[model samples]
Target: MMQRLRILTSHAAVNLMAAACFSALAALAVWGPGWVWAFVPLGVGAQMLNEYNLHRFVFHLLPPRAQWAFDLLYRAHYGHHDFPTNEKLFFVPVWVAVPMLLFNFGALWAILAALGVADAVWIAVAIVPVGGVLAFLGYEWFHMTSHLPVRKTRVERYVTTLHNQHHFRDFTKWFHVSPGGAVIDRAMGTAIDRETLKTRQRSEFIRTLGLRPDDPRLVSARRRFATRYGLTEGEIARAAAH
Candidate 1:
């Protein structure tokens, strides 16, 4: 458990979000106490929807034809699917997480203020920096645990099972990693019925996001990020052999 947490906190994105959540909660406690009860739940619910939509729509979008664009998506998500146990790829990258957090908070604040909410800024704080970020941290924790080789609690095991289905069975299903976010997946029609698909067939090209292991794009991406991501020659070769 300690090791898993160490790995979780190692990512810059995790640390930043952790700080944001704490800072926002502290600020809300001092200045916007009344708004906390209402807005925090709103933030959490909003982030749950955001988590499902981003995973289903954005991260799982068709591979880009452009090598550069493909590389970006590979770093953002494809590489995680290709190497499911790679700790480095477990959390959302800081470049992606930080910007999206800013955009969401800014947009919410603007919308509320324009609509004449007197406490728009603090309300956004309560919702985003506090509640939304807390849910994001939950996602990071569960996601990291899903990939780690550790004994898990009952709830953790359940989450890991569903997440494994997404990684190994069908990438298109089970987009929500955070607990309780599965309802969003069910509502959005992405949740697979385990009873209906008893055989649990693995998705084609499961490791490469439906691309051939040796496709030019995968080859280029692996080579391009090899040194940066510490992918040894053997790992690169093995990925291509899949």
Candidate 2:
């Protein structure tokens, strides 16, 4: 179908662009000033931070009502939440991600050039998106495998089940697809406790409160609610609390 071909072409273009960016960065790092390499980590960190913020603030909070905005957001985010295992929807559609990535990298490069760090900026502008693409690819593949009909290996099975648990039970904690694990989520106080997560699977009582799962305020709220209702500490400590 034309739709499938379009999707394939879009995915391919995004990936190719990412690869070209990486190659450019690599070439700059090898031939340019040694100091340029120092900016690599910062570039990676910026992209990661962007990913975190976009997921937290944009995708989760800013629901779209307008037709174009809704379709864009739906493809980039909402569709994933609606059907987490939909292989066709795993990677961010190229139409959405490519232009934004270029604009961001271009802007950052311009700023760095103004600061007399053009070489470093070039490297970063090249490498960061490439690294991001690799991360995106990993997320896409893992997400697809997670929902596949075929049985997974033990570790794969664990991660897939964990991701599914995040979709059906707790959406806050387990935000990272894989490899990244809970590093940023834990730092942001959005991580679900393992034991508490287990408890959430058995009880639907906690899901009634439409609390923002990533918000830290829910922690105190849970404690207060428990005290007010005379609920057991274990019950109050459920992952659904935050």
Candidate 3:
């Protein structure tokens, strides 16, 4: 397991290049002949929102009714949830990444071209890709770091805790892998904290029974424990409603 903690694998490097290059372009966009840094935030914000949308709509989305869609989405995300520690699973294979890279670049370029801003097309092109790839690289790095056995930085500890919260405490919340992506989650109203409920009393019961949250055997645990603790079904319903 300690050996698996290594970073800078070929897979990570390949996935990282898009962002590394775009970040340089972003710096140039800021300090270059055009001085179009304002668009950087637009790019960043767009990427942030895009990350949130992907997490919520795709990763967290229920596998569709259609078999093919279900298999596709399940392979994309559900397996990650089931096997969170598999470093081998973390890599986006070159085969998949190449097509996605082309599509993302072409799509953003086409979108910017359609907007028809006089001097802004090139700026938009640079900004858009920089924003997205930057966010993605940050996400992959953050996520991988969160799974690392040794966490050191203040930011790492914070984001890793949130990532743990997403995996174990509550899967539906903390969907964003980037720590500050919580801002987008909050703005969009999906930020939830079950920590209070999990830690204060209910979690005590869960611990006492030694039941994992995902344990099928614990299917009635929350309801029964809530009842014993005098919480009404309505309260649980309301909590879930959020």
Candidate 4:
């Protein structure tokens, strides 16, 4: 769809601009080399912390006063949960990205200025949004491409498959940025190991078909579906239902 293509294009453009800004800041800092390394990790870590907070709190909580904002967030996030393979809706639109980037940078700058880091705060604030955008871009791309119809490259195939499993089998786990499947999910006890996900998928499938695990018809269907898909009957059923 043209609308979907426009969204993707906008996302890609924002990502490029964010990357350029981040690189420029890094390059600027390099002139004062000693402090550059120190700042880089601090900025990146801060951004990661922000990512976790936004994902766990803002996106999931959906506080009442910000109904309009929540509606947009839900569309960008929960909507993805509702239709994981819908590539058109996968990326964060510029409407979301632009506001978030400006707000974060502005807020961080204000905080740093208040804390007496005004001179160097620009560098830090600049890096924060850039880092955030880069992370978001990577997340969007990997997630959208993962659901593409064609088979992917080796690494893409692995990550895409893993993420697909997370969506269809275990939505609670594997909440990290795509491709790497970061330890954050494991640390949070949200990482669904492959086998565990397979089991969950099967269980969900059985539940969806209005069949119990011990039902003969359910068992028969599971077996048939499993044989055809090279998965357990439960997995096949779950995949189909999803």
Candidate 5:
């Protein structure tokens, strides 16, 4: 009922829509020959590099000092970190995904135009967007399974276990969502040690925004949303007391 509708409106749905649209565009990119498609994988390498940069540089720039930035992090991410088991927070919200797409695609357009490669830019605009869509779709699926309950094949089970270690064990380590995606972290020297993230603190601006992680309002909202889909959290942690 409402839950299904909610999922459709969620950010994961945006990824699905964007992927389908770009895939169709790539298929019908009549301006180029069949050979142009062969070179698209090269663009994927660039997209993967962008993904690594986003996770490392932008995402980790959390605990903001400004209210606007804090709210942005709240909607885009960080909320997921607070309640990893909540399916509602697992996907990218619409607010976050739209601007990110504009920036990535716009930057690509600008760079291509700057290089003075008119025909080449058109080809890139087509193929590169498709690659980015597919990559993000794969990542969204992987991230969802890591948080929400679903039967996993042996390989899925293995990789998701690796990813969940980031949530339950050490947030500082294992930023890569794809299986064996840690290669990027290793190469970039961002692979952190265990529990290193817990040593850090949230920004004061977060308190000012009054949208602190896992607040009752946030939790309750998620519960209502997940309950509609029969996707309530499977486990809860109890604080220790004397």
Candidate 6:
């Protein structure tokens, strides 16, 4: 667990969110009302919902035909699928994660302020920087662990099973990576049933999101990011050859 956390906190986005969470907690300790803490679970629930929606809708969107557009999605998610074990691909990129944090917190604050909630800033703080960011951290922890070769607790093992199904079995299903967030997947109709698992074969192009291994876009993406991500020539060739 310590090792996984070290890997997790190594990312800029995680560190930023951790700092924000700690600052929010410290500020809350000084001036936040007791009732504000009650909304922490709501923030957590919001993030869980955000986790599912973003994975299913944004990250898993149809691969754009334009190379530049495809590259954005590739960095945002497809590269992770293409090289599931790459530690650098395990966390959300800082660009995506930081903007998302701003948007979620800002949107919640705007809504609360518009609604005339007297404690809009503090309430938004309670829910977002405190609760939502914590859940996002949990999502990152489980996600990174799921992709690594490590002995896991019962819960981590369970999460890995579901996440592996999404990666190795079917990209369209089991979108939730955080523990206990399977409820969202099931509710959203993205969770796979045992019967389907029994009947279906492993997905074609599982690593490439239904794109052929040598699809020009993927080939170009690999080359484009080879130096950036330290993908070896051998790894690039291997990825292209089925």
Give the winner by TM-score.
6
Could you give candidate 3's per-residue lDDT for residues 1-242 as a string of tens digits? 34433553436445455655566586665665465656666766676776677777766675355555544543455445544565544544455445555576677667766887554445655565565566666776777778777745798888888777666655666778776898877777767666553653334232112224344322233343453334466644543332
Question: 4 or 6, which is superior by TM-score?
Answer: 6
Q: What is the C-alpha lDDT of each candidate?
A: 0.87, 0.58, 0.58, 0.55, 0.57, 0.91
TM-score of each: 0.96, 0.65, 0.67, 0.63, 0.69, 0.97
Report how far residue 120 has shifted in candidate 5, in Å.
2.5
Model 1: residues with Cα > 4 Å off, grouped in runs:
199-205
Candidate 6 on 1-242: residue-level lDDT in tens?
78787888789889998899999999998999989999999999999999999999999999999999999999999999999998888998999888998898899999999999999999999999999999999999999999989899999999999998998888999999998899998888889899887754555738999998999999999999988777999999999996
Cα error, candidate 3, residue 73 (Å): 2.0
Ordered list by TM-score, greatest first: 6, 1, 5, 3, 2, 4
| Model 6: ten consecutive residues of lowest lDDT | 197-206
Candidate with best lDDT: 6
Winner on lDDT (1 vs 4): 1
Please, what are the lDDT tens digits per residue for candidate 2 over residues 1-242? 35433444456544665576667567776776765556555655555666667667776655444545554555566545543444555666666567767787787777777788656465654446655545554555566667666656776787687677666667655666555555777888877776787666533322322334433443444444444334456554544343
In the order shown, what is each candidate's alpha-carbon RMSD? Answer: 1.3, 11.8, 10.9, 10.2, 6.5, 1.1
Pairs of colliding residues, candidate 4: 222-233
Give the distance in Å from residue 79's predicted Cα in candidate 4 to where it truly belongs. Answer: 2.3
**Candidate 5 C-alpha lDDT tens digits along 14-120:** 65547654654655475556665665666556656766677656765646655556546645565566556656667767665556666766777788778896556
Error of 3 at 91 (Å): 4.5
What RMSD value applies to candidate 4?
A: 10.2
